[model samples]
Target: MTFSDDLIKLKQNRSAQEPLPSGIAPYTCSAFFKSREYGMKPKARRWDHLLSKESHNLKPSPLKTASRASGQKKLISLGTARPAPEYFPWESLSLRCLQDTVTEQAQPAPTVSMASVKLEQPYDLGVAMNYGFSGGSPQALRFVTEHIEIIHKPPYDDWECSLTCGTTSAIEIAFRIFCNPGDTILTENYPYSGAMTCAHAQSLHILGIEMDDLGLHPDDLDHKLRTWDYTKGPKPSVLYMVPTGQNPTSTTQNLIRRKQIYAIAERHDLYILEDDPYYFLQLGKSKQALASAQLDRTDANEEFFKCLSPSYLSLDVSGRVLRMDTTSKILAPGLRCGWVTGSSQVIQKLVSYYEIGVLCPSGPSQVMLYKLLDETWGHDGLFNWLRSLSLQYRCRRDNLLESCERFLPSDFCEWNIPAEGMFLWIKVNISGYRQTHTASHGDGNVARYLAVEDRIYQKAHDNGVLVSKGSWFIADVQTLKGVNFRLTFAAAPVGELDEALQRFARALETEVR
Candidate 1:
């Protein structure tokens, strides 16, 4: 079929029940920076005006004096250091404070000395005291490789890994190295907001393929490539996908889907950017224990594990696939440490981005994480910790699900129970609520007026809950429907989840009442 023919058929085959887009107007230009499209209406888009007003609150401080003040002989202008805000934890506590706390807490007075920059005795403490390899300390990479071997295997011993600041920096580097400006990248219609934003900033053409529960519909993917207008422009240079615990949507692509998607990428010679931050966050019971030692060198071997599925990195034969793994969710977000494993070419490119961009992520953060992992948890221990975490999050997900089911109006809110990841993407039926309204106001009923006003994000925030609005993810602002929002169960404590849900329900009730 022709490209146009395929596009028509795909649109027709989309779930007929899908609601029409209802949020703001289509974006006039890319919002790598803000735009005026949402500001056309004076009152309808007052939020846009408020945002503008807030942007001007910061002024750049004058540059610091190059030379020291001479003997107070009329000390000239040296930029004043503002007293650090209470919120600034870094200013309040120094590294020395942490050392003192550690020292005081030790029962036997810990042998490790906090006084010196370098430790003289035992256990190669130098790694902790010193800077590591550019790609990260060798031990971190080895541990990651070992983890990958146990989980998602690299193919043919051909793949290599590099440490990135985080997935964001890795993706930015990937975009820069593999594809040029105006290159086309295939992604889900509602892709990761960060990826979409990055691609936009780089002037890459994002070809958003429609997604289903499984992920990018394989048929749609094939159709796009097979039916593209090569005559008019270039074929897609890269295909970006978040197969496991996708952001915003929280959908996990099954192996059946991966094989098909991989096939399409291979057929089209398209680079596959498998940007999965929550790869290890798969929310299900632990799988049958296959000895970690028994696993092959490549993480590729465990691709089809029944309970916890492996990644696209495992399925890749050609070096086209670039897999991003992060410690943010599993460890702590503050660490800002993650790794990218792919072809040597890809790793080299990302290394260059690291060299020029931030040089490397925090040296101490890496050291601390590395030491914590090596000392406390070896490979097996780390795996077990992740499994325990997965279990905890699973319980959290169940709680969030239960809360929504109990509190939300049955037909009013629609969402998919995510198999893996934190978010539950929900859509509210604004029009349905409009049909029934008793007029309390002189002019019109409150419910009728409220139906026209979307509360996907605002209502929740006002009620002491917050979620990412769907409009933030959609590229075409005109196509955005304000009805949807991505709610997370990750941050909130389990005890508070029900209360948060109650707040969310009350927020919605205000409109109906």
Candidate 2:
């Protein structure tokens, strides 16, 4: 049959079949399932000019191309060397998961399983355990795609999703795609340490933009971009940030701030790498409000989504935002599974990178996630779980906040109540320490401040408390001015939070005295 004839027949078959229930699509890549019913939103503006020299040199893998051809109906694949599924040791896998709803009493967790014999199922171990496409197994990709649509629906058309190993890997891949060695990149003054290390390894220059409690300062970002210095390197074309509950700082950008930053990106023609792992941990404006509010299971999902700060992807009209999300924080970190959403062209490039690099995310992880998210907890169930999870985190945050209030000396330390995420950023009054322990040389003032920070950190450790020094997270050492520390309320038991803070307070008291 001619290609047009095949297309017509396929359309006829689709029309003849019963339609899927609302919001449900057949197992396929998100690109194939994107809704076009919104009356022709404009396609993402072309970003080919932003590609790095290395990305431009990447070509499609010959083996992957051949594998695509092998998918044709009734085609015999004598050329490929893939092992048969029978050789796989595993027959079936089962997982025990807590019920989506919170309960006053303990109950037996539900079990979900996937078996090789379940060929009739949309996804099973047989297909998932073997070699697969670089983007990911269709089942997992579909789930993330649908989740993204329901949550942050990008404003532009032709956006796509691709499964990733995790956000860390995604960051590295992004850097490779858009930046060359020695290229400058912009990020918050206090950025995630891991990301800083990743950029450093690539020999990329990082310019730290000043920030406040609301997160990255839009004025600082715009001023830095406006006053570009080519002698340092090509003007940065990328901005990396953690918009929601930013790491080390625990600052969540409000809607107005997000809009201002997006405007700056548009003005400067820069791509935004929104690394938002803490996006779902939004705890609201006040702890008391979160504590008092009762969750209505019927409308909890709607309420939860409404409370969230809009993502940069939602504001993206030109598809310059590449948002990375991971299952690490929301789920288990060891799963090492996540996904990136961006323009179709950008996603295609990431997929190509996957084919030549990791090949694909772990098959077992993808299949297990598929069974958990797609089979066990449907979209509503997952949202219900997320709501419950947020409440649990809020309780933990409250415990830590209460502890801080009771233990930390008001005269020496202060902090802003974190609106989201697992951390509390505390600013220490270091004026006394600096005055008493002045640097021998005038130029050593910053060095002297760092020494005092180290002294305080050591005192805290000796007093049996652990806290992260803010200096370790500084994107630019030259920007370091004050003494700060990060403390996490996510891992400790509620009862112990107070004791930990008390120890930290005692240590601070001794050091300042």
Q: Which candidate comes out best when scored by lDDT?
A: 2
Candidate 2 local lDDT, residue 421: 88
Which pairs in model 2 have colliding backbones? none
Q: Which candidate is the best by TM-score?
A: 2
On a 0 to 100 scale, what is the lDDT of residue 503 in model 1? 87
- lDDT score for residue 40 of model 2: 71
Q: Taking the tens digit of each residue's C-alpha lDDT, what string does model 2 give over 10-47? A: 34443554332111111235665444433378889887
Clashes of 2: 0
Candidate 1 lDDT, 1-513, residue by residue in tens: 232332243334333322211111101111111111213322210111111121223222122112222344344343433232222222111121111111124233223222221233221333333333346555455456545554664553445677778998788767766556767788887889889888889888788787788878989888888899987467776888888887778878888999988888778777788888777665652222222322223332222133567578878777678889888888778889998877654565455455445755565665556555654455544554555566567667888888998897766778887777778888776665544443444334333333334453466688888767676676454444445678899888889989988888887777643
| Residue 94 C-alpha lDDT in model 2 | 82
lDDT of each: 0.60, 0.82
Q: Which parts of model 2 have CA positions greater than 4 angstroms off?
A: 1-28, 69-71, 102-108, 118-122, 434-442
